[model samples]
Every structure is written in structure tokens, then in C-alpha cells.
Target: MRHIILFFIWLGIGQISYAQEVRYETVENISYVDETASAYAKEQCKLDIHYPTSGENNPVVIWFHGGGLTGGKKEIPDFLKEKGLVVVGVGYRFSPNVKVEDIIHDAAKATSFVMKNARKYRGDVDNIFISGHSAGGYLALMITLNKTYLEAEGLDADELAGIIPFSAQTITHFTARKEQGIDEKQPTIDELAPLFWVRKDAPPIILFTGDRELELLGRYEENAYLKRMLSIVGHEKHKLVEFQGYDHGMVYPGLPILVKEINRLVKEKE
Candidate 1:
């Protein structure tokens, strides 16, 4: 009788272990750039996808890297792994070699590709979230608020599940202004600024920034104004969070918050 009880207990433990396992796979360098685009773009415009092998209709987070629009490589942080989600790290052409406008276009093309192929990876197009640090965050806001960029590639920006930009610029990116020899200290909100396209009807947005005193170049204040304007304009789903002890490099602490937001938003949708 005791042996029989032990056998059943072992079986239950094995079942539990199997149920908790999350099998995943990684696919690298899947090009989303057009054939007509320049060779440099084709070389740089690629994405790396890491997804769970199980679970249908899973959520996907598309991550952009921060390098002030002139540098930075696509990277999937380890903090986001093994969470029953798909994370895509995107690579795009850099500045000086390519203008910031071209980079935004590349990001749009990559997002369109992800939306169209989500199902192949067992992901939901409606549950796709866009996120990134610094310049990458700027890309997320630009492609989302402007809409025209995604529309050019036959995808609607409004279809995104959420936008979570970490320490991003709401004004015209300083890099863009630098092209015209404008100083970084002098801010501008022009056609390229995400502030230029704030609307009430857009998808849910979460702006994450570091402590105001520690963040670089007023990043936290910029995002605060963005949240305020979004609210003033009637956007109900927008949220802004400031990490107390973190600085411009807030992605580490922000990753867990992202997961929480993902689960919260995705569950509400379900």
C-alpha cells in the first residue's frame, strides 16, 4: 500500500513538471527589408525571434535597441525569457549612413512583417506590443502615433496591443535635429516628433522613464508631458511610470514591469 502511494505521488510530480515546462525556439536574421531598398538597409534590416514552442495565441513583444539613432544592435534581454511570450529583437539602418526618417521606415517595415507572420509563431496579431530603450523607444512612439509609416506597408498602427517606451524622447529626436545642425539643448516638436501625433483613439500606451533627477536630458519630464497631453486629449489607456533609483538605462528594472503589463493587458483582452 505504501509503494502504491509513492508511485502515485511520483506520477503527480512528473505531471506537474511537464505542465510547467515552456519549450522555445530562436530564429535569427529574418529579413524584412524590401528588395528595392539599398544594400546597406538589406544588410542591417533583420530581426531575431524567440518564441515558445507551445501555447497558441501567445503575446509578442517587439524590442528596439537604444543608440541615439546612430548606433546600437538588436538584442533580446535575458530578463524577458521563459515567460510564455515571444520576443523579437529588431535591427535597423543607423544614422549618418541613413537618416532618422529612413530608420523609422525600416522599423515600420519590420513591424508590418511581424504582424503578418505572428500566427506562424503561434502569436496573436492583436496582442503584439512594441517596446524599446532610448532611440528604440522613440521608434516605437513614432511608428505608432504617426500611423502613416505602418500604413505605407499595409499594416495599421492602431492594431498594436500596446506601446511601452522606456526613457524615450517625446520631442523631435535630437539626432534628427542634428542633421540640420541644431543643438541638442534646443528642443523641437515638429513633424518627426511623437508629440505631433497624439490622439485619443490610439492603442494603450505605457511610458516608462527613470527618476527625473537622474535621467539624461529631461527624458522623464518629456514623457511626463506626453502622458499629460495624452490625457488632456482624452486618451484613457495611457500610463506613465518613473523608476525611482534608475537612470537613462532603465531597461533592466523595466523588464519585469513590462511582463506585468503584458499579462494584465492580455488577460483583459481575453
Candidate 2:
């Protein structure tokens, strides 16, 4: 009976360790992604890596939060924790600390860091998905269309597995144009805008937006136009889903659908 007791104790330990499957890695004070920042004093950023313990080559998602790029933590929504996938919630410097362009640069660097080290976590380097809410969605779209940022990190944007945004602005983000003294009412889509990056070769894009009438600031219409433009460019792997009853503020309640879409998109790519 003593041997039996010890066996059960060992089994319990194994179960406990298994339950801690979502491993985490943090990069504190990430002032810069370049070698120079390693020796400079600057604000830090971190990544909370969550993963399922049982998959051989799991898909990884980098989720950017939305607080108008002024505030928001590097957080994975609680619902995201048990999805049987890998999730990395990002934190970047806000608007006043840096220009809107700098925020895009930070996102690119964070993605590069993850791709460069993907093997360490049993994640597929090719299956990285960029996703976010509101301002975060706008950031995700910019990264997908304006490939320069990822190119700086030596990764091609076309090589990304998918582009998914929840209620992301498709027109010029007001915050960015505001930085240039441009009027938000007279918004323009320039090279910095995601709509400007539409091409036939873009990764499979699955866009989700809230109901048109209930959305904030013409969010649904912008996505509709973006979808049309991508279609005009002959992008066949694109989809736009309008959640019938959901509104701009429903991303928390709407992410599972995004996750399912992620699953579908990756499977198609595979």
C-alpha cells in the first residue's frame, strides 16, 4: 500500500505540472528592438506567452488591446486563457510618449522577436496571427498592409498566416492624422493606412466588425470599404463578418468567434 500511495502522489505531481501548461516569458523594459536599446535607458514592454502543453506545432496569436493607443495593458482576455492555443498579449508605448508611427514600429519588433524565437515554444513560425480590438485592430491592419515594419525585422508581411481585426478602423485612424494636424472629419487613406496596402498576395484576411448602425464612428462602413478594395485587388482569401447584434464595445464577448476564424484560416493555409 505504501508503493501505491507514492504512485498516486507522483501522479498528482504530474497532473499539477500538466495543468501549468501555458508557459510565460517576459521581456522587461523593452526600450528598443535594436542592439542600441540594449545599452540605453528607456521604458520597458513585456509579453505574456500562453500555450497549450499538448500540441506539436501550435498556432500563436499576438493580441493588441485597445484604449485609443493611449492606455491599455499587455493582457490576454480571461476567455483567451483556455483556448488550447498560444496567446501573446502585447504592451506598447502610448501616443504622447511617441508618435503614432512609433507604435507601429514597436508592434513590428515584438512580432519579429516572437517569430525569431517561435521554435522555443513549439509554435509554428509560419502560423503567427495578428489580431486586436479598436485601436489595436487599426494597428494590426497597418502591420499587415505596410510591410516595411516587418521587413525591418527581416520578415515579410506576406508570410504571415493571417490578418484578423475586431472592429478595426479601415480609414485613417483619427489619432494618427491628429498627430499631423490633419482633420479627422476629412480623413484620408495614405500609405500608412491599411486600405492603401491591399494586394492580391496579402495573407488570408478574416475581418470581423460590429453592427453598422450600432458601431462607433462608422466602423462597419470602413470595414465594408476595405473588404471591397481587397476584393477589387483580387484577394480571394478574404472574408468580412458582421456580427448582427454586437456593437463596437463587444470585442470581449466576440473574440471566441475570432479564435474560431483563426482556426479555420490556419487549417486552410495548412
Candidate 3:
């Protein structure tokens, strides 16, 4: 009887802690400009976050918007917000304002910031998941496959819990190659390409793309190539999912499945 009473007391305390957890939203203005004149202006490069309430020790997802790296906004995906997870939506200077490399670095900065400060918001730093759509997906792959960027922040790519890229580019993104006057028909695996960085021991990766026939601009093919490369490298925890009727926009059609996958992955590790 005494032990039962103690158990209830302990349960009650835990409940209070969970109930006391709070949600938060904030922005981080990160800069990348080198010139003094442009530096302060670069500070406008900001990231918005929508966090859970009280207990910040849950999973975190650093999400990016899709605009081919040339156009996009910093907004969290609708389906992701209500899934009982912390979502950090990042905004970086676009291609014309800054180079693609700079944007990639900004994504890293935002992700690293989320990871480092997750505990304060009841987020589990160890369980950080990086995901994005289209251009955002490209960023996710870059951060996961290339250790150089995240390494600079003292965070290893392997440190990420999971990576789910929604129809990212498998080859060098056309916009990036365009800067070099590289034609679309060029088959070179340039350094700017994500395909140039596949490894065997990357964190768990789940690639999702629309049906091959319905996807935009061969996006599905790019995802397929990425999956193949990951496989060729002996990636153990990588998976490829095809959204049957979904299109390029991952807003509603792909939301439920994506959330389901995250929940499944989280539950599996538990």
C-alpha cells in the first residue's frame, strides 16, 4: 500500500512536469556577408522557430522551405507543427543575394543553433532530425552527407538522429551549376553536387518523392538516384518512400505520411 502511494506521487510529479512544459517561438538573425557594408544587412538572415511548451526534451525537426534555392520563405510546414514536435523553420539569403554555399551554411547555422539550444526548450538534442522539401531537401542531404559544414560547428553529420529529404536533387542542382555556365545536359559529378558526398555510415535517411510519372522536372528520378547511391555505399538505415498521388508541394498530401514516418522512427528507437 505504501509503495502504491509512492508510485502515484511519482507519476503525479512527472505529469506536472510534462504539463508544465511550454511552447515558444523566436527568431535568430544570422549573418554571412563578408563586406562591412553588407555584413549588417546580412544580419537580416533570420530563422523562425515554433517550439513545444514546457518539457523541451522531445524530438526536434529543422525544416526548410522549397524554392530551388532562388525563391522561398522561412515557414514551418503546416502538418509538422501539430505533431507534438518542435519545428524550426529557417530563412537564408537567396542565390542572387548570396551564393548557394552561403545559403547552405546558413541552414547549418540554423540547425546547429536548434541542436545546441534544444535542451533549453525541452528538446532532445541527441534526437535532431533534419528535413526539407525540394531545395530544402537538397539542404538536408548536404548537411547530412557532407560533414565539413556541420563539423565547423562542432556537430557531426552522424550526430543527427534522422534525415528525411522530400524530393531533393540527386545531381548538382541546376541553379548551382548554372553559375558555372554548366549546361543541363552535363553529366559531371561536380563538387557542388549532393551526389558527390554519399557515404556508408550516414545517419538514418528516408527519401520521399512523388510518383515517378507525376513528379515535376524529374524530381522523382533525383530521389531514386540518391537512394541508389546511398545503397551503393552500404547505408544500413536508409529508406525510400513514394507518395502515390502526391505532387511536388508536400503541404497536405504528404504531411500525414511524413508525420507517421517520424513517429515510427521515434518509436522504433525507444
Candidate 4:
């Protein structure tokens, strides 16, 4: 069934009141790549983590920021704080400086690092989720759907607990198309598109998009198609949510939905 939700009402469903105070910590600029990697890789492929200081086995969320693949930095959203979860913000090499494949590999490497070291920060390795906004959302989908990237890191894409992308491009990212001398307005779906690699056995996916009329050109439609295709392939654990009255900058309202999905997935896993 198609699930179209109003952001305001859904936001209230996952609201949790903590009886005890929770403490959080932030560690910045930890390199995810090895020393033997290129200087640019060492500099660009770094991650920042915000985690609870006193909780054991807290769920982990790795966030990628939106900048259309050419810009933007890693950030731990303020909304995700003090929620008894570990949030990792990742930074990767931008295009023109590196190929989109390299950027995706960087994401995989960061995920591998978090999986290996989550225990050091009081996080559960098995309860890891990946998410991002816009271009960052695209990156999250790429690494999760295309197993080769994570496989190169000695990890499996299925290792993730869930995938939640906010207004991500389901087709070839416009930026990747631009690199190939294609117009941004022209939609293409090839290896770089998340739609190109749909399967029934990947992690549970929750796709969030802004209002259909207000989003970036065909953004909501692309995600809708992705949802349809996933169902056609017999994927049962997925949902597509469109926020009414919000545009492409819908990350704010979407954050609450993200938290709700994470909590729900964690509960289901238990």
C-alpha cells in the first residue's frame, strides 16, 4: 500500500519523553581512510561522531549532508542530539576532485570504520542505520544498494540495520550526469542510480521526500517510482513518505520521521 503521510502528525507518534538525563559527546575529524591513500583522500574522507557518553548498546546513525555531490560538509544534526543514539557525520571528496565512485567508496570506508569501532563509543554494531539529506541522501542509497562498494571494505551492505534517505535522487544523481557532459535536466539511470540496483533482500528502506509539487524537479516522483519498483521486486520492508507543504529543504520535518523509523526498526530487530 502507498503510504502518504503528513509530517506534523507523524512527528508526534515517535515522541519519547526520557525520564533520565542523557549525556552526549562529540569527536571531530577522525580520518576514515588509510595513510597509504592519497593525500586528498586522507584529508577529505573524515568523519565526526556524536554519541551518548553513558549509554551502552545505543543505536548508531551515520548522516551525510546535502550539497549535490560537489559541496557541503559533514554535520551531526542538532535534532539528533540527546536521543540515546550515536550519530556519525561523514565527509568525502567532492566531484571534479574525485570520481563519484571514489566518493561512494569513501562512504563505505566510513561505514566500515564505524562498524569496527562502534563499541569504543558505546554503540551497538548491529543497530547501525545510514541516512542523509539530498545529495548526501543519494550517497547513503548508493553505498547501501550497491554492495560492491561496501564489499571492497570487507563488509556487506546487508549489515546495515536500515536505510533512511531524505529527498534522495533515485535516478542517476544530476551531478554524476553533469560529469558525463549530460544536462542536469536530463534524467539518466545507470550504474550510479540507486534505482539501477533494486533487490528484495537489502536492508529496510524508508524514503522521505518533500511535497510533490514543491520538491526539486521530479524528486518526489523519482522516489515514488523507486518505491513501486521495490514492491514489484517483492521488497516488503519499505515505506515512502511525502511531507506536505515542504519543499526540497524538508530535512527539518523529516528528521522526526527519521528518528521514528530508526526507533521502530531497532524495536523490530530486538
Candidate 5:
């Protein structure tokens, strides 16, 4: 009887281990744009996908990297890997070489591609979340808030699971202003600004930023104003988080919070 009880315990341990095991795969450099797109568009509009192969209907997180809209490559954050989620790292054209509007269109195209091809990678189209740091965060907010961008791609921005931008610009991106010969210190809010598109009916969003005093010029203040405006517009599902000691480069600490929020949102959907 002792030997039999020991065998049963070993069997239970094996079953538990098997239940906890998950396999993941990474696919790199797939173009999101169509064949008719320009050469530069095809080159810059690629994305890398990292997804779990063992799970069905897993959530997807599309991440954009920060480079102030001038430079940055697609990269899957190591913290997001192997967590029973599909992560897409997007690449888009830079400013000056391409108009900022065109860069935003690239983000929409990538999102539409992911939404359309999600099931092929075992991802849940309904659980597709968008996020990024700084300039990438700005792109995430622009495409999510401004319906025209996603609408042009045959998608409704409201269909997204959520938006979680880290230290994103709430006003017109400085790069867009730079293209117009405006200095970075000057603040502007227009069609290119995320603050210009706030609505009560949009998807849930959680804006994360560093300390107000330690952040880049007006970064925290802009996000705070965006939160206030969202509340004034009667948007119920928006939130803002400030990390005390971190500055503009707060992606590392903010990523875990992003993962938590993603999980919370996913559970809410279930």
C-alpha cells in the first residue's frame, strides 16, 4: 500500500507538470503591407510574431518600440514571451523619409493584418491589445483613438481589446511638428494628436507614465490632461499610472504593469 500511494503521488506530479507546460514559436520579418505598396513601405512595414503553440484562443499584444519616430526596429519584449500570449513587434517607416500620417497608416495596416491573421497563429482576435513606449506609444494611441486610420483598413478601433501606452505623447508628436519647422518645445494639438480624438465610446485604455518631475518635458502633464479629458467625456474604462522614480525610459518597469493590465482585461472579457 505504501508503494501504491507513492506511485499515485508521482502520477499526480507528472499530470501537474504536463498541465503547466506551454510551447512557444517566433516568426520574424513578415511584411504587413500589400504587394502594391512602395518598396520602402514593404521594407519598413514588417512585424515579428511570438506566440504559444500549445494554447487555443490566446491573447495577443502588439508592441511598438520607442525611437522618437526617427529610428527603432521591431523587437519582442523578453518579459512578454512564453506567457501564454502572442506578442507582435511592429516596424514602421520613419519621419522625414515618410510623412507621419503615412507612418500611422502603417500601424493601422499592421493591426488589421494581425486581426485578420490572428487565428492562424492561435491568437484570439477579440483579445488583441496595443501598446508601446514613447513614440511607439504615440502611434498606438493615434491608431486606437482616431477611427479613420483603422476604418480605412476595414476595422473599427473599438474592436480592440485595449490600449496601454507607456509615456506616450498626448499632444502632437514632436516629430510631426519638426517636419513643419516647429521646435520641440512648442506644444500643439491637432488632427495628429491623440488628445484631439477622445470619445466616450472608445475601447478601454491605461496610460502609464513616469514621475511628473522626472519625466520628459510635459510628458506626465500631457497624460494627466488626457486622463482628465477622457473622464470629462464620460469614458469609464480609462486609467493612468505614474511610476515614482522612473523617467521617460520607463518601459522596463512598465512592462509588468502592462502584462497585468492585459491579464485583467482578458479576464474581464471572459
Candidate 6:
């Protein structure tokens, strides 16, 4: 009974330490693109960064909002707030107005900005993570898997801490293929596809998908195949998770898993 009381006391102390408030601030509407970019891109290519005011080297996660690459404002998700890490919410131009390739270029540029400015926000550049839902996830995979994109942005792709995509498409994004006169039902894996860039040496990837029965047709299967291919190519770290009852809109259920993986990988890096 005495030992049990002491254990409870330790638990209470741990909780108190964990709950200690960590003050944070937001820097909003910073343009990630330059004057050479199109007027629409200059207007739309912005980001909002939220980071803890204290801590010299907190881990940072650059989050891309999901709007199918056509629409969505920059936002720092409430789920990630005050979690002792920096979160950069990125914004980029959309399709039909701009090609999907342009949107990906914007993503790479935003990541480069985050890396260059991480120190200003007390973030650790070596521990940067990329994550997003749906189309945002697709961009994360593209920038991390295809080195040339980040190379063009003057960032090393291999320096990324990890990639945690929530319900991303591994095939050529349907919207992109649609622009090319291909039916969404007829899937194709080409140069635009994340599957096209899978390599054994790419950064760790944790893929989350919603229920196969309810998700966008073949979404889970597509990520599963990517995971299988990553393994076949001898990639050492990768995961595929499916939420049994959720559909394509499963970001909320998947956020905790993302956080857990962030912690795990951050520790490994340390």
C-alpha cells in the first residue's frame, strides 16, 4: 500500500510536468514565393507558422492543408497546438488556374522557407517533419520522395525527418490525370505519382488511410501497394494504417498516430 501511494505520487508529478504551459506565437501570411512567380502564386503562396516561444531546439512539423490542391487556407490545426513543437501551415495555388506541377513546386519552396527560417522560431532544422491530409499528403510525399523538387529549392531531400501522410493518393493525382483527359476511375502511375519515386533510401514514411470500403476508390490499396513496393525496394521504415470505420475524411482519427510517429522518429534522430 505504501509503494502504491508513492507510484501515484510519481504519476501525478509526471502529469504536472507534462501539462506545464508552453507559450507559443504565430507568424501569419508570410510569402514563400518570390516576384518571379505568377501573380496568383504570389498571392496564394503563403504560410502561417506557429511555434513555442521558449525552447531553443523544438521539433517542427510543416503541415499542408488538404483541399484537393484546388482550395484551402493556411491553418495550424488545433490538434497540434501547444504540443511542444512548431507547426508551419502552408498555402499554395490551385489546379485549373495553375498546373498540379506548379502547386508541388510551391510546396517545395515552402519547405525550403521553413528550413531556412526554423532557427528564427527556435525550431530544430534537423528534426523537421512533413505531413498533410489528402492532396497535401500527396505534396509531402512528392517533395520528400523526388529529390529534384527540393534540390531546386536548395534543400536536401534526405534531411527531412519523416513523412506522415494521411489518406494520400500514390497514383497520379486524379485531378492531374483528369486535366490530361484521363478518367479518374482509370488509375495511372506515372511521373507525377509518388509511387513513381519510391526508393529504398527515401526518408521514413507512415501512411494512414481510411476504410477501404468507404474511402475514395482504391485509396487504401494504392498506399498499400506503395508500402509493399517500398519494402520490396529495401526501404527500412514504412507503415500503412487503415481506420476501419472512417472514410476519406479520417484526419482527426489519424492525427494521434501522426503525433506518436513524430515523437518516435524525433527520438530516433536524437
Judging by lDDT against the true structure, name the best candidate. Answer: 5
TM-score of 6: 0.92
Q: Sorted by lDDT, highest first, which candidate order results?
A: 5, 1, 6, 4, 2, 3
For each candidate in turn, the TM-score is 0.95, 0.85, 0.84, 0.92, 0.94, 0.92
Model 4 spans with C-alpha error above 4 angstroms: 1-21
lDDT of 4 by residue, 19-132 (tens): 334667899999988879998888888999998878699999999998988989889999998888999999989988988878888888999999999999999999999999
Query: Where is the poorest 10-residue window by lDDT in model 2?
Result: 37-46
Question: What are the clashing pairs of model 2?
Answer: 29-44, 30-44
Tens-digit lDDT track of model 2 for 190-237:
866788887888888888888888998788988999999999989988
Please identify model 5 stretches exceeding 4 Å from their true place.
Answer: 1-16
lDDT of 3 by residue, 1-270 (tens): 999999999999999986666545554443333355355235545666676665546788888888889887888876676567878887776877778887788788777777778787667887888888888888988887888989988888888889988888878877787777887566556666788998999989998888888887777877788789889889888888888887777556666777777778888888
lDDT of 1 by residue, 192-263 (tens): 899999999889999999999999998999999999999999999989999999999999999999999999
Window of ten residues with lowest summed lDDT in model 1: 18-27
Q: Against the unseen true structure, what C-alpha lDDT does each candidate score?
A: 0.94, 0.80, 0.78, 0.92, 0.94, 0.92
Put down candidate 6 lDDT per residue, 1-270, tens digits, no spaces.
999999999999998886675678998999988889788988999999999887788889999989888788888888988888899999999988989998899999999999999999999999999999999999999999999999998778999999999899899998899889999899999989999999999999999999999998999999999999999999999999999999999989988888888999989876
Candidate 5 per-residue C-alpha lDDT over 1-270 given as tens digits, one digit per residue, 9 for 90 to 100: 999999999999999998678778899999998899999998899999998877689999999998999998999999999878899999999988998999999999999999999999999999999999999899999999999999999999999999999999999999999988889999999999999999998899999999999999999999999999999999999999999999999988998889999999999988
Off by over 4 Å in 2: 1-35, 38-44
**lDDT value for candidate 2?**
0.80
